[model samples]
Every structure is written in C-alpha cells, then in structure tokens.
Target: MDRFIWSNRGIEAGETKLFSQVGVRIYDGDQKTSYDDGNINL
Candidate 1:
C-alpha cells in the first residue's frame, strides 16, 4: 500500500468539505501505482 497527504484549501468555511481539495501522491517503488480518479488523474 501507499501513503498520502490531502488537503482542502480555499474553503469558505472552516468545516470539512470536498471543495478545493488537493491530493499529494506518495509513491512506494515496491508497489507500482498512480492516481486513478478526481483531479489527480495520474
């Protein structure tokens, strides 16, 4: 499995929401992988 850190900035409210979200893909060479959906469609 891989690890990642995602964030949602530019949100109008402090409450958690799906808008303006960003994803950081942390790759593990042992496992061949890449983003499959959403904005990070790698």
Candidate 2:
C-alpha cells in the first residue's frame, strides 16, 4: 500500500510537470475563466 501511494504521487507530479511544460492552465473550481495571457485553460 505504501508503494502504491508513492507511485501515485510520482505520477501526479510527472503529469503536473508535463502540463506546465505544455502551458496547460489548471484553475480552481471558483476560477472558471481564462486569464488575459491566453494560455490553454482547463
């Protein structure tokens, strides 16, 4: 179980890095609109 948790965290971190590298914007629930810089919003 501990290994599984660590692997999951690693996957999440990798995904976040990939997203940032590709200019993906991940906003909170309350922030539904894109910013003025025009990056991809999700």
Candidate 3:
C-alpha cells in the first residue's frame, strides 16, 4: 500500500489519500479479558 502511494501512477489530480492507524486486540475465551493489544499500520 505504501508502494502504491509512492508510484508514478499515484492518486489522481484533485484527489486525496488518507491513512489511518489500526488497533488490534485479542480477548480471552470469556470475552471479558483482553490478552493482548497492539497497533498496526495498514
């Protein structure tokens, strides 16, 4: 995805590109406890 943003055939004129940070969480079987939490770049 980052490669495409840097390529010549990138976003068109008058267009916009947006990036967001995503978060992930792993829950236990009970669903009441979170085992892990992390952030990822999409």
Candidate 4:
C-alpha cells in the first residue's frame, strides 16, 4: 500500500532512480529481532 502511494508521487515528481533495502528482520519466540540495512551510498 505504501509502495503504491510512493510510486505515484515519485512519478509525478520525475523520480527515476532508487537505492534501497538490503536486509531482513524477524522475531521469534525469544522476543528478539534482527535487522541489517547496511548503508545508503547516495
């Protein structure tokens, strides 16, 4: 749902490129989560 809205705005704003997400996060029975989204070079 968020992607649809973002793409609409991006198109109208002439956005032609993107550098994004590079990781995952999950929580188990231990109530622990892991996330690693590195860096955004741009």
Best candidate (score: lDDT): 1
User: By lDDT, is 1 or 2 better?
Assistant: 1
Model 4 agreement with the true structure over 1-42: per-residue lDDT tens digits: 122121213333545456644453433555544423332211
Error of 3 at 16 (Å): 0.6
Query: Which candidate number maximizes TM-score?
Result: 3
TM-scores for candidates 1 onward, in order? 0.19, 0.21, 0.23, 0.18
lDDT of each: 0.44, 0.34, 0.43, 0.35
Instruction: Give the total clashing residue pairs for model 3.
Output: 0
Model 2's lDDT to the true fold? 0.34
Ranking by lDDT: 1, 3, 4, 2
Task: Give the range of the ten consecutive residues with the poorest summed lDDT in model 4.
Answer: 1-10
State model 3's lDDT. 0.43
For each of the candidates, the C-alpha root-mean-square deviation to the true structure, in angstroms, is: 7.5, 10.4, 10.6, 8.4
Residue pairs with colliding backbones in model 2 are: none
Question: What does the lDDT come to for candidate 1?
Answer: 0.44
Query: Mind giving the per-residue lDDT tens digits that candidate 3 earns over 1-42?
Result: 122122225457886767534465544455633324544233
